[model samples]
Target: MIKIEDITFVAAEAYKRSGLVLSTDKGYLLESRLAPLARAEGYPSIEALIAAARRESNDRLLWAITEALATHETFFFRDNTPFDLFKQEILPVLSRARGNMSTIRIWCAACSSGQEPYSLAMILEEEKARLGGLRFEIVATDMAPRVLEKAKAGVYSQFEVQRGLAIQRLVTHFDQSGDQWRIKPNLRSMVTFQKQNLLENFSGMGTFDVIFCRNVLIYFDADTKKRILQRLAAQTASDGYLIMGAAETVVGLSQDFAPVEGRRGLYGRSGAAKSAAA
Candidate 1:
């Protein structure tokens, strides 16, 4: 069994780096996720690995552990409702509201392995004619370098492509490579991937017309969730929308966003947030 102190150390480190609140009850996750890392890093066991990390003050190993614990199991068009809302509702409104502007910018936070942003790119490509020459900028950010590298390459295994991706979309936007599929260059070019820790300030990134921060806040504590939501509000355009995970809500935690009626996970900037942005 891993020592309680070691588990506590991991939980503390995860919180410090990413604001992730790893509960003591879920300590088995450390053993399951970090066991491979320990073996690959030449440690005999997870306990030995943690011992070495503590003894050496190994920031790199600690970061690796945190990355391992982070949930990266995302697929294309995850949870169809949000993407449907983006294409059907969000786009038309933004097109009219920003007709004078040249571009519509979308931010996909915690974009693991590029699927979410790439899915958006495909929708934008399909709607280009309707948009009347309006350009699109998709900024995809994740804190893990390993997933960022995979996202940049734009390659996916057959099973990965099959998940949440329609066959027609697959044929149109990807080229088959052996048993793997690679997202075409046009779709790949639409997104710019960066390593960003959501715990830090996003001021340098500028405002976004749409922000997809789905399924990420559930990992953080309530206070952390409130802080991130407030920052997200500041970085959203006054007329823009925020799409979160269906299971996540900002009801009591924040007043920066108010839900768009009839839309499960869609939110519009509140009056308070708009005033602050002004």
Candidate 2:
């Protein structure tokens, strides 16, 4: 059994590094997730691993702990509504507003294992003729190096592809290699994946016409959520949209964005923002 003190340390360290809250009740997760890592690192137990990590101040091990605790629960087009809204509502609006000459910039924050961005890429491909020659740039970012590597490879197992990926899309956008499916080179090229931490400054990453930060903020505390929402707002174009997970919202947490009428999880620059700009 993992000790309370060790659980506290792990929780605190994870929050410090990733802004992920790990309450004491989640001690079981620490044990289950970190056991393999502990054994791999030559520690007899999670306690010893945490002890050594603390004593040696091992940044690598600490980061491994954070990564292990991170919820990488995602699949291609995980939620159908968001993608439908993007393809049906968001794209038409963007195409009309920006015209064919301008490119649409999309940032998929915390995109896990490449599914989310790839889903968007597939939509763009399907709608290419409809878009009137408008170009698109997709930048996908995640905090974990391990997932980013998998995302860059553009490969997924049979089971992975089965989740949320239609057989038709699979046939069109992927080439079967043994038991794995590899995303077509053209589709893979549509997204640029990079390592990014939401806790850090986003000034270098310029504004985006659409930001998909879905299902990410629920892991953080209130302050952290507010901070991330504010940063996201700053990176959003004045008329751009912010799409979050169904469970997350800008209400009470931030005044930088307001919900797009009748659209769940879709937000635009708030009235307060407009007044401030005016």
**Per-residue C-alpha lDDT of model 2 across residues 1-278, encoded as one tens digit per residue:** 88888889889999999999999888889988999989999999889899998999899999999998999989999889889989888888888879977999999999989999999999999889899889999999999999999999999999999999999999999999999999999999999999999998887999999999999999999999999998898999988889999999989998999988777888888862321111
RMSD of 1: 2.9
**For model 1, how does the per-residue alpha-carbon lDDT over 9-62 read when each residue is reduced to its tens digit?**
999998999998987788789989999999999999999999988898899999
Q: Candidate 2: worst 10 consecutive residues by lDDT? A: 269-278
Candidate no. 2 TM-score? 0.96
Model 1 alpha-carbon drift over 4 Å, by segment: 272-278
* Local error of candidate 2 at residue 106 (angstroms): 0.5
Colliding pairs, model 2? none
